[model samples]
Target: MEFKGAMGGIYRLTEWITRLAATNLLWVLCSSPFMFCLILKLLVMNQNLANESLQMNWAMAILAPLTLFPATSAMFTVVRKWVMGDTDTGVFRTFFKGYKENYKQSLIGGIFYTLLFVIMYVDYTVYMTQLSNLQIVGVIMLILIIILLVSMFNFFSMVAHYHMSIGQIMKNAVLLTLIRPFRVFSTMLGSAVVIFIGVKYPVLFLFFIGSVVAWFAFFNFYGTFLKMQDQMEKMKQKDEEQESVEDKKSDNLQK
Candidate 1:
């Protein structure tokens, strides 16, 4: 029996808050090593230790493929259920289940993305600073980096939603980013807003940033996927209708 009063509203609001907070907390906990390294890098930067900061950056890059990527994919999985209207799904059970199931693909994806990002960033720096005449190349690299960043968001969503190989997922993620500019920009804007707020209010990072962003990103990605499916269905129906017309004409001619 559903309660019909302010009490019900309050109960739902509290439950929703708890779900987001708990999921975010679990993500942070599972990816603690990466977080620790990030924090260390920030501290080093504040101290103006350029060499130590660079070391921390490498450490984060290495540790991220192992910890952050898988954990993030798992978080996306949890949020995917909620987006698909399974609000009562158990957060802990769903999160770890996603992590275990998607670990290999996520790890492979993480390594590839990490390496690509590092190489592009280094190239971007070199072209901009060392080879000043090739600034256009640096701009192109920057664009690719942005595209990659947005595609990475879609990567997590695809991991949660699709049962494709890593290669297929990566190909589609990049294709979707390039072809669906509206969706790509919308997801990027939403995530950037959430991240900006999360950064400004550090406390939110502990309980909302990661999970909320994952939910929003996956929500947008799923919307794009549904639209594509609808288009494919329409095309298939058109083909069948054309074939039916041809078959009827041939039968009439034969008669």
Candidate 2:
């Protein structure tokens, strides 16, 4: 009996891991184009020569959103559903559904964010050119801003998944970040490391690694959220059941 129980536990754990891995794989495949476009945008942004060709840079900037926004929005939607136990939705269906549903909002959000990023970049360049003394503070502020933006994106993705309004999503995201800073940081750091490795190697293995990382990060955020949501629901149910039982006992005594 003990051996059987232990074996069953192991099997269940393995199954859980397998499911997580499968979900991650699906997410990566669905979101590949967005990922590629994002990387390309980052590359262009990092290049000093990119600033020299204003038209080319603008073109890249414009294309980046057109290529990546809808895809990313769809990827997030699919991954959120998958994490919430909707295993029937295949990668293609999820991708298309997400893309179609979120196209306009994603486009608008992407344009807004991208414009903000460009403005920040120009500001940073101007500051760097003018002041050598404030470089460290500016760099630190830039890093903080990047982290905040990424967190906001994650929150918005969750909002999109849950069909929540942007305002509510932003509020919840801010609360979640304040309450669970470590988890948020871990997710971001893990994702950054994976992407960094992918970029550093830029070979097949690295591509695979980055894909795996992206998937893991996407699912991890949603999965953890779902688990917490489930737990809360369970607790609420239990409390209601207990209250009902107590009420029945009291009525019986009165009778």
Candidate 3:
């Protein structure tokens, strides 16, 4: 028993470490837009290349969706497979396969969400100077931003798991995110802490940040979805039973 327990613990540790390394490495390679522009900025920002730096920043910002869409979709796929105990699909292969498979949908999703966030930011900036009803617009925009980001966690998960249309995905994402508020809060908190750690200790960005945050967030989402599925099944069974009971009662009344 002691040996079996030790082996299990070690296996889990090794599995986690292996996944973290693989996920973060894939994340780095896939985030070329941000990394390349960051490197360019770092090299030129202090060299009096202000105009070029600005252009690089603009390119990075504009490329954000294109860069992140496929990668995030792929990451979510890899995470799902890992969590599902499907050891058959190799991590890198799974990520690339998902990236290719979901490329079009992810690109569209990325564009939509990116535009939504950008619009929110722009509107917030425009309204910051005003002290009128625009404040209400600003507040609404802020709320939308929160909802968008919160739903984003579930959106990627859903995209990985479902073959729904973009509109369907969006609607379900919003609903699922709202269905489990505590899950969203935990994911947000985990993400914030990850960002703080990455900023404070840049070395972690290379190996730990992305995978660690994603794994924890994915855990919460996976549990929420499973619980929801069970609850829905229960409700469905209850409805069926109630319908059967009503049918029987009607039959007796007719008799």
For candidate 1, lDDT tens digit of each residue in 1-255?
Answer: 455777899999999999999999999998999999999999999999999999999999999989999999999999999999999999999999999999999999999999999999999999999999999999999999999999998899999999999999999899999999788889889888998998899999999999989998998888988999999999999999999999999999999
On a 0 to 100 scale, what is the lDDT of residue 171 in model 2? 60
lDDT per residue as tens, model 2, 1-255: 999999999997775555445544554564556555555656666785555456555765786466555655665665566556775566567667777877766666667667867877776776677777778756865875675566654654664566766556556666766666776777778877876776678653322553354455566667568778899999999999999999999999999
Cα lDDT tens digits for candidate 3, 1-255: 999999999998997788778878897889877778877988888898989987886776677678776787888888887777775568888889988988888888888888888788778767766656578877887887898988888878878889989889978888877777888888999899888989999888778787777666777888887888899999999999999999999999999
Best by TM-score: 1
Task: Assess the local accuracy of residue 174 in candidate 1 as a C-alpha lDDT between 0 and 100.
Answer: 94
Worst 10 residues of 1 by lDDT: 1-10
Query: What C-alpha lDDT, on a 0 to 100 scale, does residue 114 get in candidate 1?
Result: 98
Q: In candidate 3, which residue pairs get closer than 3 Å at backbone N, Cα or C atoms, i.e. clash?
A: none
Using TM-score as the measure, what is the rank order of every candidate, best first? 1, 3, 2
lDDT of each: 0.94, 0.63, 0.82
Which 10-residue window of candidate 3 scores lowest in summed lDDT? 125-134
Tell me, what's the RMSD of every candidate? 1.5, 6.8, 2.9
TM-score of each: 0.97, 0.63, 0.86
Total clashes in model 3, counting residue pairs 3 or more apart in sequence or in different chains? 0
